[model samples]
Structures are given as structure tokens and as C-alpha cells.
Target: MKGNPSLAVFGDWDADGIISSSVIINAQRHGMIYPIRGQAIIEYEPAEPVYLSIRLDEIGCFDAIAILDVPVIDRLLESMRSYRARCPSSRIIYIDHHISTHEKIEDLYGVVEEPLVGYVPTSRIAFDRVVSLGYRPGDRLKLFVDAVDLMDRGAMVPENMKGLLKIVSSISKALSYKRDPALWRSAVDWISSPVPLSSPIAGASMEEIARLAAESEKRIRDEANILAISAQKLGVFRYIDARRRWMDRGASALASMLYRKLRAPVILCVASRDRRHVLMIIKYPGKAYRVVKMLMETGIAVSIGGHSSLGIARIPVERIYDALEMLRSSAIY
Candidate 1:
């Protein structure tokens, strides 16, 4: 596997995904400690299901593929299995922290699955796994990984980590569920650099994004406040905001703010940017498994995925009420 091995690394566009891919590629290039040796590393960061499907077609070209921090694995198992059967020498590695997909990952054949629990992000998982394989990262690298974990898990305030958390959050906001290779490369370089994180590195567009995120937060706060007082609770507190541009961006933050304040299972459906679709975000604290299982059983949500206490699903605009009824009947929320 050491001689000019072709490699493909796939991850989400979020902090965990980008950092995890960077760790693997950096290890592969140095070859001083990590067991992985690859001649060329190809990276794919898919922003949506359509893009992900397209990238899946390219998997057969690589000798090894690492899927990190990608939660929607049930849709890829068949393609992966076919690829493995076609290229018996190829290897696939999966690392994730989404608890709802544990069984699915366990079922995939001819791949290495490293599923973690609690607030651990795939970057930390990749770091530990690489170290176990004899890759010794420096103190700065470890600290950066730890900062990412804390930021992703919402475990720290803005004051902690010497302003690294703000930097990561600002960068992620600028990315906005989209893949920008150049911006991503800059972020990777910063994380892998030996210098300690001291100042914020906002991309050209990041200042604007920061302002927009602040505005969105205010709208979400007001909406969530209304829901906290008036949402209908049928197994879960359900609220739908069909206001125009309600989901222009940052739906997850809204859902999180609601959950943090309500301290109860919350289901939020926000109109999509096009107003022709709805995106659902559910947070159930210790009951994420039940909520995810219920949604799957309904067979309505497309590309559903969940971490330990939060889940997200996409639904057709017309089916929003039907989905709510299904959730109400499931009694699992």
C-alpha cells in the first residue's frame, strides 16, 4: 500500500469533516509516523445528496477511501459493497460520531468503522486512530483537534480556547453548508500549522457572514420564544415557521436555541430557501435514537441523520403536516 497508492477522502463540509480529512492527508504525506502511505490524495466535500451521489460514482477509481463525519451511510452501503467487490485490494475507512447509524456501519462489509460516542468528533477519532497506528502528532496539532471537538460539541463559551472557537465558528458560518476548496485549504493550513491560534482568520466574506448569522440568530430567537409558549406538544413540541426566507440560513442554530431553552423534545420545520421544501430539525436530548427510528419507520424523511441528541430530515413541503401526524402517532419523541 506504500507505493504510489491512489487515495480518496470524503467528508462533510463542516469543521469535523474538514479537520478529519486534513489529518489523514497530512499523515499520508509525511509517512514518518502514520501507517497510511498514499501517492495522491483526492478530496471530495459534498454539500447535498445530489452531489454526494455524483461523488459516490468516483469511488471506484481510488485504492483507498476514507468517509469521515458523514452520517447518511445507509444510502451508500450498496455502492460501497459493489466497489469493494470490484476492487478487492481497495480499502474503505469510516469514522463518525452519529449514534443512530451505528448498526448500519456495523453491517457494512470490507470496511473499517470507527463510531464514537458522547461529544467526540471525527477529527479526534481520526487523531486517536492514527496515533494508535503509530502517527505522533505534535502538541499544537492535538490542541487544534481538541479545540475543534469543543467547538463542535458546544462545550465552551466564546472566551475559551484563546479565541480558536470563534475562529472555527466564523469559518464554518462562511462555508454555510457549501464546499469551497480554496477556503477549506486555508482552514486546513491554519489547523495544521505549528503556530498557536491567537487571532481570528476571517475569510473575505466571513465578516458579512458573521453579520448575517447575528441577524438570523435574532430572528430565530424570537421565533423560538413564540414556540416555547405556544407549540403543540404531541409527544414532541412541534412548530412550523413558513415565513418567507425563514430558512435563508442557520436553521440548526434555531433548533439548538429552542432545545436549549425549552429543555424538551422539539421539532422545528423551516421553509426552504425556495419555499418549495421543508427542512426538519429535531432535538430530543437523550431520546435521539427513538426520534430517528420513528422518522425512519415513517419512510417519509429523505436523507435523515442524527447525532446523540439531534436529528435532521428533509421533507416535501406538502407532506409537512402528514409528517407531523406521523410523528405524533409514533409516540417515540
Candidate 2:
């Protein structure tokens, strides 16, 4: 293209997002990857994927961009269209594992797309993509990817999965607080090398994660017992108010704890953080592909997306009870 082309890389704040962006960045840095229509190699910067939706006006400056691990495809269409109009030849690549409807993908044209939209983690997809392009990351990186996938998918076997999850949890808990983009980059770089999982590169991250995990676990242990006695049950689902003495830990960890303690096929945790808004996290078994569609059909949720096992949504505070009732009766799950 013109001078050194700018390529903005947007990824979510999860381990999958961090690794996905890292793979592309490492490949580009080693001259193993290049832009589609540029003579000079591309220079990229990492950004939170939500920025593209909230700050659409700033997208035109980049000659090429890659989005990783972030789903909300409908929110991105307008910005992608704007950028495409501004720079007709610019490249747009989107890679995600969130299940998206076919209609959403059809709205965009001329964008390079690789959406697994399955149970697979985005990091695995990134790994395969990089390998297809002839870049081979070390085995440690593969182990790191498998750890994240197993943890996310709630795999509890093979013995080593538990230890691997502890390491991933330490990194996740540390990242959840500050979420400095540099920390994610450092994690990618560290795992890309020969460092073992127990290396001191993590510093006190494991201790911090343990503290947070313990607090959350204790809360769940206490409250889940109360919920089992009090919560209304519909079929195999249990509806629990998640606000009671709940710590501000990560949602995945909380969901996992709730599943183990409650022993329910589905656990819907509803919390009204403020009088103006209500937040909910639904942890369910099987593929919940129709849950979002059914929830939005009720005109209750503002937004919702995640894996089939876990989902997060926002609603009006006044409608919390109504939303719960709707969810109970909908039978979408």
C-alpha cells in the first residue's frame, strides 16, 4: 500500500483472545505473515475488541485489521462497512468461535472470515490457522492452548488438566483486574518460549488467583446450599439470585463452582447490580444456541453472547423477575 501499513488487532480479554492475537503478532514479527495488498510489512497494535463497536470513527486509519475471539458480529457490521467504504482495498479479517447466525455473516462482503461457531475455543482455531500458513509454535504453546480449552470446556480428566487449569486460572485472575494489554502480550511471549508452566514468570499471580478463587468458592458453597432449598425448579434448572454475598470473581469460575455445588443441569444466576440495570449469567448443559434468540424475543435482554455452557446478559432492573419467569417457561435451553 502506502507507507508502513497499520493493522489493528482486536481481541477479547480471555486467554483464547490473548493467544489468538499473539499467534498473529508473532507470525507477522518473524516475517512469516504479511498484508494482502501491501509492499511494506504491516505494523499492528492490540486493542479491546469492544472498541470497534463503541469507537467506529477511528477504524478508517488502519489499512488492515484482524478481530479475534470476540463474537458480537451484529455490532461490528456498521463499522466494517464504514471502514470498507473509506478504504475500498483495505483488508478485514475476523476469527471467532462464538456461534453466529448465517444471516449475520451474509451482511458483510469482501472480508476474510474464519468463524468456527462451534464448541472449539478461538485459540485452537488460531493455532490451526497459523500452522496452515507454515508457522510452527513450540509444544509449550500447544499445552497452553489445551489448558485454556479444557478449562473453558469444563474437562476434568487426564489428571494434568487440573494443574494446567490452575496455571491458566492464575493468569486469568491476574488479567481480569487490570487487564493491561501488555500482560497478555507478555503471557504469549512467555509461553512461546521454553518456560515451564510453573515458572516464576507468573510471580504471585497464582497466589492472587487462589485468594480470589477461595473467596468465590466459599460464597458459592454457602449460598448454593440456601439456593437448593429455596430456588424454584423447572425440570432440571434452578434459578438462584446471584447477588447474595457474591464476590466479584470471574464469571467462568463462578459458573463452574455453581454447577458443581448445585448439581443442576442449568443454573440461572440473576443479580441486580443497580436499580437501573440487572445482570444475569446462565450456565447450562448442551448447546444453548436458541437461548439468546428466545431471550431477546421477550424484549428483556439488552445484549447476550458467550459459549453454549455460559451466557451473560443485561436487562432492566425492574424486569428481572419477569425475565426469570420468561426464562423458566421458555424451554429454549
Candidate 3:
């Protein structure tokens, strides 16, 4: 890196994203003696650019800009390219797993991307990539990672997870009770554990952490069909909430939440959210996938492409009700 950003980290709200952002932010928060010395004027930003600029202006000029778990929007990338053309001294570091591109996105001074699986719905590869960027992982970050994995990926508990002797043991519990459970409490605790959305150093303290995690869990359980997790935080981190059922991890969280609650039928995943009202979808497992293909065959005026299992297209919310009605008549809904 030519020079580290005065200081900033950006990622999605998922476990991978949140943790990734926190790992770096905490480095500053808890007072890590980073060999990479940042200018005291370098301020950290969260959520909004409007307020962030207030501080950035006070600092005068940012040395570098670091991007994490999330992605750089195409237009913003264009803007950066244009701005950089004017200011030759500025540099940027982008570490991300999103941004659907076959070749690595070029032009940025430094770029690192974790693979957003072409075959699997979850960005498992990307999550690991996020963790690798940290200069060193903290215990708090580790616990936060377990919390997200428990809710997002560690849905399966092993035989050893039955005893709630340890605090961070949800995956073990979930796996232990994948089918039936003598100790579902541990699994529930894991799901209920506060997956840190932001680090205590960044102002999301441990006390607040539990509450946020509980809120997120309740939201996912009650509403979303798919649930994605990340340890980073970013601007404009997108999650597809077409039916408000799809949570984050594609069809798995959807199916589990549905059946765990009432075995409700319709469960699927989409490629994009907040993207021009169109969607790319992946309906997993059973014949539900076939229903997706059937929808495209109806000659709906939209771009729909993917396998019977996975496809991409876009649809407006204005047509959402009509689409649902169509699915209702079909056997999938």
C-alpha cells in the first residue's frame, strides 16, 4: 500500500463484513501499536459520509481509503477514477468478496477480493478472506466470529456440543441437535448471542453487543427467509428482502427458520437487492427450483437467467404481489 488511509474501514453488516471492519477498527480503538502509524488527524468514519466529511474536513485531507467486506459501486468507482485523475497523491485499498466480476477489478491502487462462491450461495471463501486481512485477531473478534457462524453457518451442532460448559459453542450444539435435541438450549444461546455488528472500540460496547445480537436474531427468526452473516460493517451493504423472508445465507436459513417455526413452503435466494427492482434467484433443493423456471417461461417481461437451481433477473416490487399470486397457484408456494 502506498500509504494507509488516514483511517477508515467499510464492509457489509454481515459477520464477515462486521468482523473484518472491527478487526481493523479495534486495532485503533484498543490502542494496538501498529507498525503502520496513522496520522493523528486521521479520523474514523461510520455509516454516513455527510458527518464523516465533517471530520475529514477538519483533518484536511485523507492519506488513504480502505475498503472492506462490502464492494465499490460501479458509479462510485467511476467517480473515484475521475477524482484520482485530478489528485495524483491519493491512493485506495479495496478488500472485498462481493462485486461479481470474472477478472479482478483493476485500477484501484491496492485490491484484495475474497471469492463470492459461484457454486454456493454463501460467501464462505470471502469470509475467510476478510479475517486474513487483520494484522492480528483479538479474542473479542474471535467470539464475534463464532456468534455469526453459529447463526449463519454453524447451524449444525456436533455430539460434543451438548454440554454448555463453554460460552462460544453454538456450532457444536447446532450440529449435535441437527435432527433432534436434548440440548437445544446451547444452540438457542448461540443463535441468541450478540453477533457484534460493530466493535466496542468503535462505540458498540460489549454491553450493547448482546442486545443488538438478540434484536438481529429475533428479526431473522420472525421475518427473513435467508440470513447472511458477516463481521464487518459497510455503507450500502445490500441484502435481498424481496418477501422479507430471505435472510442472508441463501435457502438454508430460510428453510431452517420456516420449518423450525412452521415448515412453511416457499424458500429461495436472490442475486441482488436494491438493484433496479430486478432479481437473480436461486431456489434450492426440491421442486421449488422448478417453479422459478416456470415463472420465467410465463413470458414475464424481465431478464431471468440461471439454472433450475440458480438464475438471475430483475423484477419490480409493483409486480411483487402478482408474482406471489402466481407462485401461490403453482405447487411451490
Best by TM-score: 1
Write model 1 residue lDDT over 1-333, tens digit each, in one string: 455656666766677777776677667665433334545654544333334545666656566677777764555666666666777776677777766446564565344433343347888988888888777766767766787877766574545575656666666655653346666666665565555554334364546646644664566688778766765676656554534435735677677787788776778777766667677878777676567566667777655666757777777778777888887777572
Angstrom error at residue 103, model 2? 6.3
Ranking by lDDT: 1, 2, 3
Ranking by TM-score: 1, 2, 3
Show where candidate 3 strays beyond 4 Å.
Answer: 1-5, 28-42, 45-61, 99-216, 223-333
Task: Give the Cα error of residue 223 in candidate 1, in Å.
Answer: 6.8
Candidate 3 lDDT score relative to the true structure: 0.39
- Stretches of model 1 off by over 4 angstroms after superposition: 1-3, 31-35, 38-50, 111-119, 152-162, 177-179, 195-236, 243-249, 260-264, 271-277, 316-319, 329-333
Candidate 3: worst 10 consecutive residues by lDDT?
A: 230-239
Best by lDDT: 1
lDDT of 3 at 33: 25
Q: Per-candidate TM vs. native?
A: 0.78, 0.77, 0.47
lDDT scores of the candidates, listed in order: 0.65, 0.62, 0.39
For model 3, state the Cα shift of residue 251 in Å. Answer: 12
Instruction: Count clashing pairs, candidate 1.
Output: 0
Q: Return the lDDT, model 3, position 283.
A: 39
